[model samples]
Target: MDLVRIGDKVISRHKIDSFLTEILQLRSMGLSQTDVAARLGIDRTLVSRLENMGELRKGKSVAVIGFPIANRDEIYALMQAEGVDYVMLMSESERWDFVRQKSGIELFNAIMELIALAHSYDQVVVIGSGKRIKIIRAALDKEVVGLEIGESPIQEDKYVDPAELVAVIRAIKGGNV
Candidate 1:
């Protein structure tokens, strides 16, 4: 057990951790704040404040897909940091290699699988040429956030602004857009 000393008062870190775990478990089990507080003999506001402090995003799963991106590594790191559930990013050459490596039937099956997986998420963010984004949006049934990096027939990798993508992600997570 870890101990913390504040002047003459001593606190057990283990006890505090266990208490917090119980509170969160109760909340996850669908207990109301008031009910949890009454059972734990704590204030209702404490439960509310604890939940607010730990909340990262609204309970929605998000997926991000981008291709022929110049800054794929930067965007991939950003997506991981932001807790994006699914990420598919590729450079121009990588995209071509991917297509060239697969047979026609294999490619079709793979695309169908990707679309099926994407349908499981609450929202999808597609970063590509305008036409590709439109096509993806039309295929998906759920919310689709499009970040058009270039016009149709984009042959070269285009750089996407990290700040712009972050804003879109935050808006979606905050239920603002």
Candidate 2:
């Protein structure tokens, strides 16, 4: 990598590339075009053009992942009505059985698969406790809308309001939540 010197300052192509990559990543993570441009000392139009140029997937797709849901049927039905693309809902026993059924490698692969599937969607709706919600958000590292049912070490299913979840999903899908 050759560093170009201008007066007392040095400019690097690698550094520029890294900066652009960071800006693009931030945009992908849901930053506004104007914010990204301001952060990087670039034009907002350029940011918009860059995003349009890089878009590989179009439209908003949503994925819902939850466990130990008390109103599973109601929530699932509402999600179905909302036209959710991917839905993964499990009870406590079902979650235990799922984990116990998989070996180490299988579990790892399954987790990766889930992550990959979640990444494909524009938004991921996670329904779980606070701790698990944070973990999912960090793992997905995208636009995650968490539905906190309760705290960790959960012993009972949390009752969810279907209408409330639908409204939240609607807001998220509309890019307001």
Candidate 3:
């Protein structure tokens, strides 16, 4: 009985660590708090607490985004005590299948939703970004009024400066969005 209990505890810690890392990475990728919350069917406060464990957790109305966690019940209680959201367990195959068939526009909107939900100070930069992830670049082009940094093969003539890209995002927040 002792050995089995020890094994379970070890597995739980390993799962939680992986869950935390995945969540942070997804947030960096541009998913929003609200999206994450919606995905988990919980409030944004829970998400924030889950992300920031050591510091005093501050709740904001911003939409949050990140990975869907596994072992959610355990994470939830941990969040209550530690001030973070817990994991929502999904099998690896399930996660893969969801992304495999998701449309580009759907992916882009998903990313933007996450970005919008993030802290104002956080800048979610998609590096070497391309349209392959989804039809997001084109959709973003239409919906987003700011400067886009990446080069698009489809739009052979259109180009945007990297510095201007930051300015554009700032401007969008200022009123352009």
Candidate 4:
């Protein structure tokens, strides 16, 4: 345990941290603020204030997935800047390598896992060929925004305009897209 001496009193940082963790865990487990406060012997307003301090935004979660992208780095940076919940971007060579390195079952399991994760997001932005976008839209049940970089069977990496991607992200976060 670590102690901090302030003036003539000693404070237990560990105790404070444990209380914070417990409070958040209880809140996440569907406990109301009043219930959590009563259980923890804290003011209900403190719980509300703590939640507000940690809140990032007040909108739906978003995911961005793209492959065979020449500007993957640029797009990834934009996703990070916009605080996207999930991001998956790959170049043509990287995508080919990823498929070739995995066994048949492993590849299938990986694809299934990706689809399951995408299902958790409120919206998904798919950037690829028209055919690929159509396939993803068919697989996912949530709202999907398709930004077609090229026609079907895209064999080469296509450059995605960074400004266009930023606009899409802004619109989604603003709940207008």
Off by over 4 Å in 2: 1-59
Residue 107, candidate 1: Cα error in Å is 0.4
TM-score, each model?
Answer: 0.66, 0.65, 0.25, 0.66
The list of candidate 3 runs beyond 4 A from truth reads: 1-70, 80-91, 120-177
lDDT (10s digit) by residue, model 2, range 11-87: 99898789778987887688888899888889999887766665434337888999888888788888999988888
lDDT of 1: 0.89
Error of 3 at 132 (Å): 18
In the range 41-132, model 3's lDDT, one tens digit per residue, is 66788778875653322232111111222333343343344322322222334446566767988877865764444323222222222542
Q: Write the per-residue lDDT of candidate 1 for residues 39-118, one digit (tens) a residue.
A: 99999999999878765444379999998899999999999999899999999999999899999999999999999998
- Can you tell me which runs of candidate 4 are displaced by over 4 Å? 1-59
lDDT of 4 at 89: 97
Q: Once model 3 is optimally superposed onto the true structure by TM-score, how far is the C-alpha of residue 162 displaced, in angstroms? A: 40
Best-matching candidate per lDDT: 1
Give per-residue lDDT, candidate 3, residue 102.
74
lDDT of each: 0.89, 0.82, 0.40, 0.88
Say which prediction, candidate 3 or candidate 4, comes out ahead on TM-score.
Answer: 4
Steric collisions counted per model? 0, 0, 20, 0
Candidate 3 Cα deviation (angstroms), residue 81 = 4.8
Q: Any idea what lDDT model 2 has?
A: 0.82
Model 4: per-residue Cα lDDT over 68-87, one tens digit each: 89989988998998999999
Q: What RMSD value applies to candidate 2?
A: 9.9
Better-scoring candidate (lDDT), 3 or 4: 4
